[model samples]
Target: MWRGLRVALVRERFTVDGVAALIGSAARAALDRGETTPARRAVRAAGAAGALVRLFLLGDVLPRDEVAAALDPVDVDEAVTAGLLDVDETGVRAALDLRPHADAGLPDAPPWWVLSDLEVAPGGRTADREHVLGTGAASLSLARATVRRPVDTLLDVGTGCGVQVLHASGHARDLTATDVSTRALQIARVTFALSGLEVECLAGPWLEPVAGRRFDQIVSNPPFVPGPPHVEHVYRDAGLGGDGASALLVGRLPAHLTEGGVAQLLASWLITSDDWTGRPRAWLGEAAEAAAPGGLDAWVVQRDVADPALHVGTWLRDAGVDPASPEGTALSERWLDWLAEAGVHAIGFGFVTLRRTAPDVAGTVVCEDLRQSHDDPLGPEIEAWLDRTAWLAARSDEALLDERLLVPDTVALERGLVSTDEGWSPVAATLVRLDGPQWRHDVDELGVALLGGCRGHLPLRDLLDLLALAHGRDADELARTAVPVVRDLVRHGMLTAVA
Candidate 1:
């Protein structure tokens, strides 16, 4: 569908107006007339009414008028049922003037329509609507990872429209969905039923609904945006204190997982002054260790860190509350005050995929920022992280350092030589390109040039002697600098230390 037509046709008022009502009424009348399968008959009648509405709206005025003059019940029925005419501009304009609010009711965003094997507008939002279920980047990421795992019992926390629950049904034996919003639960129930999915639904906040329940896989797109205790509509805000909500969800997982159970979630948390890595680790560590005390192995990667104002604006925009409005302005103020009170300058957004962290089996959680497009519903790249084995905390500088080392011939020289605007010429290089996280070195041209020559055939001492003979520079000065450069290469895992 064209964007403009979609916008016009999708409003809840339009769905309920003249056409929808007429079709509904007509379907009821047909049912009374002994139509086979009343429900299907009603839908067909409603669809016909919608089609007629579309025709009068889309057709030319004089032509439609002539057609209307000659139109009989059969013609109207066929036109409405088969969509001979479209909902045109004039009809839409007239409908707009007729006070849709007085006639049809509340405004709404477009619905997800699967037409001719094509998905049209999966979901939409209106000006005042606070909650809507639509798959986002984070949600999609979670979905991809969840399907690949061999999970028996799947749990979707805060299952808005049960997107994750639906996705998980493909792999999970038994699926359970929990949410705080009753309205969302209603939509979710319908969504599951229509999709031919059967899920056990629970209504409660956070982990309250499924207390003491253990699952092989737990996936959540929780409300981790830190703000005041409002916006309970349930997509953006989780009414928990501090990182209370995020931590609460994280804190409880260990207890709810069987030996090797895995939990995947997308969350945001306040970044404090103390150790950034230690902060998230503290949640899985500490007194809660007994909860699932195999010692939860965590990989918490700080992706995009945002300051207070950015965090505030992010959620405010998500809520669809205009900052210019009085209520919007007040919301903004309250958010600023809350963030300020918490001493939160920036918040982090990323995935937290955890396992039971049992002692017998090493449970791992890898946190890394892999920015990529997961557009395909069933693509392999989406599950790459699920197969990730690297844990930053578990490995040492030596193990990390050793990764840079090469066995003889594979080592390559990579020099970075550039002149900045300030006329400072800096040239830097290594024995083998450093692969460590923190690659630090001085910009000494001769050091890079000399390191490039070491191929293990000529001893380092011979190269210095030749350079000393050619340039007549001090061999001692050249040799001294050479040792540090080689040491740095070895230290950073660029090259293995020669035995």
Candidate 2:
């Protein structure tokens, strides 16, 4: 048993070329047979390829039980010493590292640690300190969540590990990736090459490579940590304080985006007491000045909030810095000092999606900060919310009554059905949660309903009067409660005002 386990480990490390070829061939064949569609094929290939790559690095540590209980103490020791197995005894794992194509100003020679067979380290003792290629959950989140759209070109600013480039390859016919670190571009190239995708990886600051190029889609996961700056990592720092880097990057988008183009990004922002809205809005002003006067739709969704210390600590850990270590402690001190110096106390993290289009085109800019379950994003709920809003925003009380619709017996605020931002146009309905669904309100059942009753003939005001009479509520009170709800529904597309 020990001999067989040792053999398996050797095959995983790719140290034994014959075993590696066999593992690679089997995994590839399995993936090919499993894939039925392009999406499935991509998923299968990525998973199978990653597994095969891991086997080469982490083979020696495979549990003895899984391999007929053959692992010996010496085999485990040798594997650990060789840097192919992790320190943890039970859960052996491999780091997924990648880089883009060459000519991105990265070093021509690969890392000595990388084994020749799969061109990656075989459990080499390498610390992921550098802001190199992406191999994190957030990076994958951005990659997978991105939906393909019609676009002439795409830009990935601050492209690390070129994960964005890898995902963007399928969507954008032409792709350009930029990073301040030439080393990052180098890594991005390696990743892209291994994955069999081509992208123009540039070694430069954000938007520098394509100073005048216009793209239909632009996506970035910029260095969004807010802090003071001295020495900076090209992938992270913008020589600014809390969310300063994000501002700096966002402030540069309008001129770079083509007409009717959209830019989606995840970033962090400092929440100020004065007005949370003004800070991010300032980016739009800067963008407008850089390009032609056009329609701009900005949607900023704040997903999470954290205090300065928590924020700093989270980022420090993310960069693989050990706070317990002397160097890590010093780095942490510097980060805290930077935040203090920046006049920032708390930070908000979330997404910002912007669309640049023609003026006079029906477009909108929405900023919302809401509590949501991150683990379960209700895509269907959001879709339903949108559908209800569309129906509401398009019709008037009279029209709604004419349709002779039955009001739902009850409505609950299941999650989100309202616009949190001010200055939105109004719709003429109320949002109520129902049994496993959301629906409109019954006009007759509602006492002093904000919207008119569905009497099948009466205009909105008369229906309100009828409701008012039934409920013994005054006109002023009823109007105050109902008009805004109606307006909100209209604005939100929950109810429609007749054209």
lDDT of 2 by residue, 12-35 (tens): 332223223434555545634643
Per-model TM-score on C-alpha atoms: 0.56, 0.62
TM-score of candidate 2 to 2 decimals: 0.62
User: Model 1, range 100-211, lDDT digits (tens) per residue?
Assistant: 1111111232232211100111232232223544555566656654535556798888887666775666568899998887756765665565345678999988888988
lDDT (C-alpha) at residue 128 in model 1: 29
lDDT value, candidate 1, whole model:
0.54
How high is the lDDT of residue 425 in model 1?
60
lDDT of 2 at 262: 68
Q: 184, model 1: CA deviation in Å?
A: 1.5
Question: Listing every candidate in turn, what is its Cα RMSD in Å to the true structure after a full C-alpha superposition?
Answer: 14.0, 12.2
Q: After superposition, how far is residue 122 of candidate 2 from its true place, in Å?
A: 13
